[model samples]
Target: MQVTQNIKAPEMLIDYYKAIEDSSARMLEAAKHHDWDEVVRCEGACAVLIEQLRYRSQDQELPPEQRKEKTRIMQRILRNDAQIRILAEPWLAQFDHPFEGKPQVLH
Candidate 1:
């Protein structure tokens, strides 16, 4: 017999925040390894989670305890993002002017 596992969607706004925090952490890890593709993939996941969070937030509010947790999650996510940016600056600089000294017009 084969068994299937069901995954559940986050039911609270704070849950979405947690998911975004998780994605940011993954992105930071990928940046540490210089895995640009994985970083981009995790970033996409964060974007989707952020959009979902915005929609759900319109109808739901976090409890006091969850709000405190959400604040912590947001702080951690921000720190991860800052580190990722620091790691990416050099990598991103390479594309700043790929056509330097090349002809302005192709012919």
Candidate 2:
């Protein structure tokens, strides 16, 4: 979608937040596979992409109705990114540190 110069930062921030999860997934996967190189590469890529979205994304945002979508874009993206990060963390941890102890059910 094309954005005008007036686009809001919050709206763009949502997308930037979202890309975090996508990037984290790649990081987690690479870690899972013992591909530390790939993990590092993905982290760099993700950082750049997020920076671009946060810093370079621009569009004209005007009219409440027109701005709604961008607003929603930001909200939804941020939410997704957070959830994905939550899930990815444990997965990444498991990959990074293996336990030789007997598995115990927490619940």
Best by lDDT: 1
Candidate 2 clash total?
A: 11
What are the RMSDs of all candidates, in order?
5.7, 10.7
What is the lDDT of every predicted structure here? Answer: 0.83, 0.56
Please estimate how well model 1 matches the true structure, expressed as its whole-model Cα lDDT: 0.83
The TM-score, computed over Cα atoms with residue i paired to residue i, of candidate 1 is 0.85
The residue-level lDDT of candidate 1 at 25 comes to 83
Candidate 2: where is the Cα deviation over 4 Å?
1-12, 56-107
Kindly report which residue stretches of model 1 are placed more than 4 angstroms away from their true locations once superposed. Answer: 1-8, 101-105
Clash total of candidate 1: 0
The lowest-lDDT stretch of 10 consecutive residues in candidate 1 is 1-10
Candidate 1 residue-wise lDDT, 1-107, digit = tens = 11122223778888888788888888888899898888888888889889998999888888887878888899999999999999999999889987877878866
